[model samples]
Target: MGSAGVRLGRLKANTSALFVCDIQEKFRGLIHGMPAVVDTASRLVRSAEVLEIPVFVTEQYPKALGNTVAELALPPKALVFEKTKFSMCTSDVDKAFRKMNLDGIGQVLLCGIETHVCVLQTVLDLVEKHNVEVHVCVDGVSSQRETDRSVALRRLQGLPNVFLCTSEMAMFQLAGDSKHPKFKQISALAKEKRPDQLSAL
Candidate 1:
């Protein structure tokens, strides 16, 4: 839980956005549970579209790492940025946020690869520099080693502005209730199984 005065509340579709980071073709073989990460990230992207939430994606050095995985169904209007920076909070990313008119966004939902490196750095930067609440999809993030992912998650959990969650939890929270228009679609998406590697998380 966050500090009592912090007011870290549930995600509101209108005030939240999704950021997919560095889940590229190059790491498909290197990262553990790549399939699960792609699947969960895809589900989140689709759910975001259904809920009319904005989505942004970052590819770390696309020339070397390749583009985002084809399995993931990125929304047509999603903003895509290619960057060399490990932390995605670069000027280019900032420009994209500005272009998208994201000044009102309060929370960012994050999903993607190498949890210990790029993902961790981006989460810290978003919370400290941007002053926005960050929620990580545990099942949608990973590293080459399980230990790296576990350690990174443990470290991130200690941050007051960083909220750790699963893809299903985020989807439901964003939907708010069973009566939400997208509830049935989100519910179906949640029923899909993630890799066994994410089972313990």
Candidate 2:
């Protein structure tokens, strides 16, 4: 419910990126709502593509865990960064981040699987070291246990530069306009699974 106001100056196309942490095979079945996570991430990727914003993804040891889930259908333009480290702020990872021109990125809108560990660690690192604003969409990330997910969200909300939001809020912010041509397409992606409305889209 708490929010660190969006940094409009740095939230522009070039100053923000979406980091999708291990929403891969080995971890998919273990999360609270796998399908919803896939849908939300898919919608995010679609929005990012329409807006021409950079999207970054991480695969945690894909050889053992497997690739990102099939439902996501990540954009080919997206940057897929491989890493073994839990925290992406480590020397090598940070270098990759810098190479992406993320040093100027003031806000990082994050969404992915496994909210309690990898997502939490990455958010803290981005806030503490990179001094980047962190906004995590609650509905887009989850843990196998609700209690752990709740605890992690509470801790993230207390941080200096972090915001916890629902998937709708994040998507609308990125959309910036209902008149945008891709609005219906992006909206369709967001509403893909609502039983009553799915057919309409």
Among all windows of 10 consecutive residues in model 1, the one with the lowest summed lDDT is: 192-201
Expressed as tens digits, the lDDT of each residue in 1-201 for candidate 2 is 135754432244556688888888897668777776777777777778877777778888899999988877888888787778876556765766676654565667888867878899999888777777788877677778777777888888778778777656776666667897667866776676632111100
Candidate 1 residue 135 Cα shift, in angstroms, is: 0.4
Q: Per-model C-alpha lDDT, please? A: 0.86, 0.73
* Cα error of candidate 2 at position 200, Å: 26
> Cα RMSD (Å) per model?
2.1, 4.9
Which runs of model 2 end up more than 4 angstroms from their true locations? 1-11, 90-92, 99-103, 194-201
lDDT of 1 by residue, 1-201 (tens): 257666565888988999999989999889898888888899999999999999989999999989999877788988899998998778988776655445688789999988999999999888877778899999899999999999999998888788898888899999998998789998988887666647434
Q: Stretches of candidate 1 above 4 Å error?
A: 1-4, 98-102, 197-201
Question: Candidate 2's C-alpha lDDT?
Answer: 0.73
